[model samples]
Target: MKKIAITGATGFVGTNLEKYLKRSYKVRTLSVRYVHDQIFNITDDIIIHLAGKAHDLKKVSNPQEYYESNFELTKQLFDAFIVSKADVFIFMSTVKAVADKIDGVLTEEDLPNPQTHYGIAKRQAEEYILGKEISKEKRVFIIRPCMIHGPGNKGNLNLLYNVVKKRIPYPLAAFQNERSFLGIDNFNFMILKILENKNIASGVYNFADDEVLSTNELVQIISETLNKKNLSLAIPKSIINGIAKFGDLVKFPLNSETIQKLTENYRVSNQNIKNAIGVDKLPNTAQQGLEQTIKSFSKK
Candidate 1:
């Protein structure tokens, strides 16, 4: 069995991947407080670096938080990979590195113009890794995945689920928008496939559940999964947009961050990931994954 090193094992993505990896490999973790020492001998091992600064909702996170955790930490890890002679290195980056708001379907070709400090920091790390020199035994990959959600995740999706569970009508029903998200199941599968498939070229890739769900569709899924009536109103979008504008002016809860999330067309394409995995099939559809997550949410 091969040796595997993972950072952010406590995070949703890393924890999900570890479930399968621990069964067949010598799995190790690089704790949040430690770096470039001890069990982190990357020699002849696979390193999946998942630790990074997550996007801050309240905009309270300092700019240095992103650089120190995302860029500097990754830099330290990559330097260790070089010294320890690692074979494959996977960096868990985010779609925000490419664009914070999307006008259409996001692909690997889009030039990165990250708006937030978090995105900027991740993008900087990506640039640094891409600029490095490597020998025959080493490979590097930067994977930018959209919002990842799963059963145990307590993210925006779960918040939406809770709000819907309370039968609170979503105010944004006025905006018919589509967005993409990665199911943790599919993400775990993709990471494993990428690690195993040597023919897949080393570079950047985007991962997401294939189906694009509108906000209303997402609410309906939650409602049905929890056995509630689909209670939504399709009010005119103009009112909602105006309200969002006012929210921004007042720094209200439905402020710029929330508006961008609820209305942005963050439809990232999974073609590069599919091509790398040497298949057109995804392990789980968006609906299936969402169902599983909502079921878990109800139990909690």
Candidate 2:
């Protein structure tokens, strides 16, 4: 079995990936806080770099933390990988590395214009990897995944699930937006394919589910998962915008950032990656994966 070492192994994605790959690969979790140079000595065939400062929705995190954890640490680990015998290196990046707002569907052809510290840091790490010369025997993959959701996911989706569970009406029904989401199962499958297939080239790839869903559709799915009636209010956009501004001033639950998140269209195209992997479609459809996630939330 190929030996795989993953950073941020205790994180949501890392934990799930480690468990999923353990049966086929010898998976080892590496500490991001440890000596960087020692990464070369881990004796792994593959390294999946998942450690980085996640985007802080509260905006309370120090800006420098993003660079230190995402860029600096990744640079260190990657440098070690270059000299080591590791044949494959997979870096977990984000769609935010390209653009905060999607104009049409996001693709690898688009130039990066990151607006946040977290996105900038990840882009820097990606640039560092791209700038380096790789051995003929080695391959590197930088994946930009959109909003990921699955069992144990905690974030806006969980919050929405709670609101629906409490029978609260979704007030953002007036907003019309479509979003791309990555399911853990599909993501795990992609990683496994990347690890097993040497024919695949090394490059940046966008990862997302086959289908996109609007917020209204998502709310309906959540209600259906709980076997409850869907209740959504189409509040006027202007009214909602005013409330969001007030929320910003008071640091309330529905701030400007949260509002943008709920209403923004962030469609990402996975065509390039899919073509490269020679797959017609991912294992799970967006609705199927989302229903599974919503069911998990109901159980909680």
Candidate 3:
């Protein structure tokens, strides 16, 4: 079995991938709390750099937090990989590295024009990796995945689940936006496939689910999973904006940050990646992947 080393093993995607990869590969995972001893034993293996700082949702803090963890830390890890002579390198980059607000479907051709510091930092790290000339025999794959969702995810999904559990009426149902989200299962399958193939070129690839989903669809699915009626209001976006602004002034939950998240078009196209991989399409459809995720909420 091929040995695999992973950073951010305790995180959402890492833990999920670890569970699946243990079935076939010998896996070594790293944590900041641990020493180099955790990553030292695994030499000449495939390293999946899943560790990085995510975008700050609060919109209040220093931008350095992103660069320190995402760029600087990744540089440290990639340097170690170079000396170790790792066979393959897979870096978990984000679509945000390309744009803060994707006006239309985003493709690989777009030159990165990141908005926030988080995006800027990740883009810098990606450039650093791509600029380097590693061993001719080795392969490198940089993956820019859109909003990823699965059972163990602790981000937006958790908030949606809470809202459903509380039976709060979703107010911003009028906005129709298409957004792409990757299921963890499909991501795992794609990563494993990349590891198995040697002829695949070393370059950047965009990863996402088969189709885009709207917020209304998400709400309906969540309600179905919880076996409850969909309680949502298709109010005007302007009115909702007004309410969000008031909420922001009063220190309420539905502030500007939440409004932006709850209603934004971040649709991404994986056609370029599909063509590069010489594959027809994704392994699972968007509906299938999302249903599986919704069902998992009742597992615990």
Candidate 4:
């Protein structure tokens, strides 16, 4: 069996991916921390780099942390992979590397203009990886996955779940917006397909679920899962804007940035990846996967 080494194996996605891939491949967790001029000794046939500084919603993390963890660490690891025996190198990037807000459907064709340190750092690593010349024997892929959610993930979705669980009225229901999400199962499927097929080509691919859901729809789904009444209040958009501005003054969590995140059009196109993988549809639909995630939250 082929051996796979995964960084950030203890993270939400990493833990789920390890379990999913171990059934078919010899999987091992790799502990990687950023240090200058550090040498990585890798012998696995496949390497999935997942360790990186996540986006800080609370805005408390140091900006340099993103550069060191996302850019510097990846540069070092890719350098190691270039000389190592690894045939496949997969870097888990984010769609935010391209843009923080999209006016239309985000595609691979769009030029990158990242705003946050996290996105900027990831973009730097991507440029470095794509600039390098590689031998025909090896393949390199930089996957940009949008808001990924699953059973054990305690991301923004979890926060939303809690709000709905407590029967809080969703105040952003008035703003209609659509966003893409990546389920852990579909994410693992994509990774396995990339590892198994060499014809998929080595390049950047935007990964997301097939269906897009609005914030109100998501709230409804959570309410359905919890068997509670959907308390989505259709407050006026102007009032919400005023409240957000006031929040900025009061240092409330519902600031302009958070409100924008709650209501934004971030539709990602997974058509390129779907074509590359030769699949018309992923194994799990967006609703199905999200429902599963909601169910898991209920169990906890």
Candidate 5:
């Protein structure tokens, strides 16, 4: 079996990926504390870099932490990969690296203009990798995945699930928005395909499920999953905005940032990656994947 060395092996994605890939590849983890020279010493045939500082939703993390973990650490690792015998390197970036507010379906061709420290830092790492002179023998993949969810996921989706479980009405149902999500199963499939296929050209590709879901539709799905009636209430947008402003003043839960996150349009195109991987569709539909995730939450 081919050997694979992964960074961030203890993370949500990394743990799942290591388990999934162990059937076909000999997987090992490189410590996050390792320097560039230490990374270069690994004898793995593939390197999957997943270590990075995630976006601080609470806005309490130090600004320098993102740069150090995402940009600087990736720079060191990529430099090590350049000289190492690793034939494949996969860097896990995010859809936030491109744009915060999507005007339309986000494609791989879109120029990056990341706003937050997290997004900006990931973008810088991506730029650094692209600017390098890679050899023909090596393949580098920079995968920018949208909001990822699965059995272990405990993100915004979980928050939504909690609201539905508690029988709370979804207040922002008035805003119709579509967003793309990447299921962990599909994400695992994509990486395995990339690792096994040597003919696929290395490039920046967006990863998302085949279907996009509106927030209201998502709430309905949650209700269905829980065998409960949907309690989504469509409040007027103007009223919601006013409430958000009040929330900002009072430091309440329904603040501007939370509202934007719940109603943002973040449709990402997975066409490029699908084409590259020689697939017409992903393994799971958007609804199927989300239902599975919601079910997992209920068990907890």
Candidate 6:
């Protein structure tokens, strides 16, 4: 079995990936962090770099921490991968590295103009990887995944699930916007397929579920999973805005920033990755994957 070394092995995605890859490849979790001139000991045939400073939703994180952890650490690891015997290098980048709010469907062809420190740092790492020259034998995949969710994910999806479970009516249905999400199963499938197929080439690929769903649609999915009636109120945007502005003063969870995040258009296209992986459809449909996620909530 080909040995694979995964950084950030304790994270949600990394832990899942380590379990998934263990079925075929010999997988080992590597505990690594950002340190200047840090030399990595990588004896595995494949290196999966999943460690990075995630985007801080609270805006309290030090901006420089993002650069050090996301950019500098990735640079150090990639440098090691290039010189080591590893033939495959997979970097887990985010769609945020491209745009904060995508007007249309985000694709690999879109010009990257990141707005936050997290995005800018990741983009810098991507640029550094792309600028380097590697031999034909090596494969480097810069994967940009959007809003990844699974059983272990404790993101906004969990919050939405809880709201639906409590039978709280969704009030922001008026803000009709589509967003893309990636299921962890499909994400694992994509990574495995890329590792198996050398013809996939070394390039940037955006990964998302085949279908895009609106926020209303997501609430419906959560409701359906809980076997409850979905009640979505099409409250006017102005009313919601006023409430959110008031929330900002009292430090409520439904503040202006949270409301914007709760309803924003972040559609991403998985065409390039699907075409490269030679798959017409992923293993899990968008709804199926979402239903699975919602069901996991009941177990907790």
Q: Between prediction 1 and prediction 3, which has the larger lDDT?
A: 1
Residue pairs whose backbone atoms clash in candidate 3: none
Residue by residue across 183-272, what tens digits does model 3's lDDT show?
998899888778877877888888998799998888888898789899989989888889889988999998787878878898888887
lDDT of 1 by residue, 41-68 (tens): 4554889999887898767987888898
**Where is model 4 more than 4 Å wrong at Cα?**
none
Root-mean-square deviation (CA) per prediction? 2.3, 1.5, 2.7, 1.0, 1.3, 1.1
Q: What ranges in model 5 sit over 4 Å off? A: 34-39
Q: Per-residue lDDT of 1-300 in model 5, one digit per residue for the tens?
A: 899999999989999999999999899988875344444465788999999888888799999889889998898888878888888999999998999889999999998999999999999999999999999999999999999899987687977988999999999988999999989999999999998889999899999999999999999999999999998898999999999999999999998989998998899999999999999999999999999999998887
- How would you encode candidate 6's per-residue C-alpha lDDT over 85-168 as one tens digit per residue? 999999999999999998889999999999999999999999999999998899999999998889977587967887887888
The lDDT of model 2 is: 0.90
lDDT (10s digit) by residue, model 2, range 1-300: 889999999988999999999989999998876344444454788999999889997789999899988998888888888888889999999999999998699999999999999999999999999999999999999999998888898566977888898999899998999999988999999988888789999999999999999989999988888999999999999999999999989989887888888888999999988888889999999999899888887676
Whose TM-score is higher: candidate 2's or candidate 3's? Answer: 2
Q: Distance from true position, residue 238, model 5, in Å?
A: 1.9
Residue 148 shift from truth in candidate 5, angstroms: 0.5
TM-scores, in order shown?
Answer: 0.93, 0.96, 0.91, 0.98, 0.97, 0.97
The TM-score measured for candidate 5 stands at 0.97
Per-model C-alpha lDDT, please? Answer: 0.84, 0.90, 0.83, 0.93, 0.91, 0.92
Tell how far residue 70 is off in model 2, in angstroms: 0.5
Count of backbone collisions within predicted model 2: 0
